[model samples]
Target: MKQRLIILSDLCGSEKSDWLIYYTHILNQKYDLVYYDSCQLGNVDTSSNDQQIIHQQFVEGGIRKAISQLIELEQNPIKILAFSIGGLIAWRYGLLTGNIKSLICISSTRLRKEVYKPKGEIELYFGEKDAYRPPMEWFINQNVKFEVIPNKHHEIYTEREFAEEFSLKLCNIQSH
Candidate 1:
């Protein structure tokens, strides 16, 4: 009865980020929300091991695994909300298969390298301070809907205000 929303986590790999929480609060009444954490590796406290494991698990290989996991789940039209590396992974996967109904990629600067377009309604967000972000002209060239949040970074997903603002965007999007 409710729309299914799948949230893919960032390179940092926390599926329950503030953005997720904010969107859940706003859309829970109408959507079934699920969090998908990418293949997790070592703890952040152990820097070297964490870096090595994360790189090994969540690179190109992890994108395939994430897509497989999504398809391997129940067959349903899913809306996706992804961050950073997760956004790139989701974009890659979504392009391969038309499984997503809509997609929102937040701070997924690395997506610039990908040439395939997704089969769903797509929107992207970036922060001015994001070092890896694609130029605004690039988004315009690609004709992808995007917004640039002022004076923020890739970590804006964890910020309460940013989350709340993003939640509003999601709310407004589904209303039509």
Candidate 2:
């Protein structure tokens, strides 16, 4: 049987996210993929496109709600490919439930607020230009592996080239 890989979307969820094809097309061939929309999981209102409004909703209560909902839905070990706010949800899930096999977080700037690290094979990627990305000291203190992609910004994961390259790298890692 193929390994299971869970994909958690960014705050935008599936709305206007054609870029997801860049990763899904490649990852589907090697794993049994399960996709989750962050907004739906968190019960965030996405009627408006204002990022600030959406982000505020998540900050108020959505993130916690999503984590709880995900824990209730997934009980077994999981490997996660999460973007932005989705990464934060996965991190909290791993911390609370502790069954993550591996976690790859892309552009999860909000992680700067976290102090404790979860137990898992964790990899974090951030754009060098993303001001909200956690400082190098945070990574060192957490003992987590991280990479800063040069000349990129917060939404770097949306790029097709980056998605393809990242999917290739993910395929090489053995999942349990």
Instruction: Give the number of the best model, judged by TM-score.
Output: 2
Candidate 2 lDDT over 34-78, as tens digits, reads: 999999999999999998999999999999999999998899989
Give the Cα error of residue 141 in candidate 2, in Å: 0.5
Clashes of each: 0, 0
Q: Positional deviation of 129 in candidate 1, in angstroms?
A: 0.9
Mind sharing the TM-score for model 2? 0.96
| Most accurate candidate by lDDT | 2
lDDT of 2 at 1: 85
Root-mean-square deviation per candidate: 4.0, 2.9
Residue-level lDDT of model 1, residues 14-56, one tens digit each, is 6335456766787676678887765442122224446456656
